[model samples]
Target: VDIEVVQETGSTNADLMSRLPLLQRPVLRVAVHQTAGRGRAGRPWLTVPGGMLTFSLAWHLPQAPQNLLGLPLAIGVALAECLNTLNQNVQLKWPNDILRDGKKLAGILLESAAASEGGTWIVAGIGLNLQVSDELEAQVGRALADAPWLAQMDRNLLLAQLLNALASALQQFAGHGFSAFLPRWNALHAYANQSVHILDHGQILHAGIALGVDLLGCLVLQTEQGQVNVLAGDVSLRPA
Candidate 1:
């Protein structure tokens, strides 16, 4: 894998996607300071220099895009499991958000670009908070991952460990698909088996018990209508 670390960047994911056309080997681009980082629904990811760890990894895949629909969930499983090895209480929210002790600690965004006449390339961007401030805490309207070591851990060591685990997990995912990670994801799910509500905008679309995820990485909700498979998009899940 090729590694490039920048002092600053607009968004590593954007950069990787732009370079995807010419991409040959796997590459990992890390930004020490990300000026323009955004998560799902275009929400800005706030961070300060050395306060957060931001990076993006790009790789070519022989599989078609549709067949990798559950890629994000698999990535989340990789991240949560890595963190769990270092510190306990690492749980995953559906799709791909890392929650530490029920609070958001890190966010992941996965994007794929297809080269003309070739296979697809995917970039997985990650934002992990290293140090939290009262100001940063105030800016977060929702859950934020909080832990004592997050503010004191060694960034380099953390980055190395995470990158290795991610690369290995991605390789396994390419062979086994999301089915292999489903059991692991369910084991670390923060809301598994809990009553929850799936919300789009402010409206509740479905209310049911969270039964973990299916092989395709769709959230399995046991609703009144039946077992409903929920896709991740503009929708949000919350405890009911």
Candidate 2:
């Protein structure tokens, strides 16, 4: 599967990991409309051209699976199993952010490149906001009109069922990694038990409830003064 339907891109995973080693094909897809996209604090992925569903994908991971280190939590369990097939309350927030009823919509950005003589080459980008025009959610300053639980959806059958459930969850995560996707990523977790705000490296780590994600993907809160994993982070679901 090698697709490419572009119009603009400042980051389809950095223009497909800079052309994936002159590509010969190991499954490369690239659907874009707009994305000067960026996230994980650098934040900028509002991406509105035709309203959203930007994309990117490159492949290859022959033996890479050291506990999976949460490759964006397995692309947020492949976009929450493709927004649970459009019934969509879309969960999944840790490490990748996609939420629907809770507001945000979609996002997944995994990048890796360094194979000049080294190794590694990933690209997996995505951005789905299907259609939320309050003038693009106020130019994405954020406040989807008080989230009315994401008022029903359609968007071309939810982007062809979210690219066929993210190509069957990236072919079962490049063939069985992340423990075959941590029990459907703790069943589409969205702030797993609740209290949050990890942010790290500027120190704001106070947590209690979010226990899911540790085979290296880090983030496993549960604190009343106890469990706290986190590794290169961000948590933020606080406000109870």
Candidate 3:
């Protein structure tokens, strides 16, 4: 893994994609500051200078397993483990959101290519608010809140820990797929025992939450009626 710490870049993921085609060799690029970052649903991620950890990791998984449907959930577990070393109580929200104290502390975005030949190259991007100011907070709106625990923390050290954890998760996922990591994913899940509303395809699935992710990393919802397995989508917490 090669890290390229730049002052600023227009969407680290975009930058890597642009250069990947021209490079003779395969490599990973990590942009410390992504000026135009983004998230799921093509929403812009506010990446202002100071106190925010933003980076994109590009890797070519040659022998990637086809059943890596729970890769994102596994990444959440890795992030929780990394943050635990910093003494933070972190939990994973479905689809790839990192929560601390019921607020978003970090997020992971994974994008995969069909592979021009055969193998798949994935770009796993991560963003975190280490110490956002009030001015920036106002710009962020209700999407996120200030994380005080991030204050006075070492960004480099945190990044290193998170990368290491993610690397470990990727290795395990590539080898044993979802089955090897589902238990850890369930343990770090924030809404495992709570009621949640699943929003997908203009339909809402209201059900009681069961522990652990299905093969596709979906939230296993055990409603009053029966057990229903939900695949990836947006979910809102309903009062239990």
Quantify all predictions' global Cα lDDT against the true fold.
0.86, 0.66, 0.73
- The order of the candidates by TM-score, greatest first, is 1, 3, 2
Give the CA lDDT, 0 to 100, for residue 135 in model 3.
72
Best by lDDT: 1
Best by TM-score: 1
**Residue-by-residue lDDT tens digits, candidate 1, 13-110:** 98998888788788999999888898877778888666888999998887664567688888889888998888899999887789887888899998
Please give each candidate's TM-score. Answer: 0.94, 0.35, 0.87
The residue pairs found clashing in candidate 3 are: none
Between candidates 2 and 3, the one scoring higher on TM-score is 3
Write candidate 2's Cα lDDT for 1-240 as tens digits. 677766676767777777877765655454546657786556677655665667777776655655445676877887677566645667777777777667777778777665553456677777776556676777776754222222245544655666677777766766766777776787887767777777455456565677777666666777877887777545455424
Sorted on lDDT, best first, the list reads 1, 3, 2
Clashes of each: 1, 0, 0
Which residues of candidate 2, in runs, are more than 4 Å off?
Answer: 1-3, 6-24, 32-49, 73-93, 98-106, 109-125, 128-132, 135-194, 197-215, 228-239
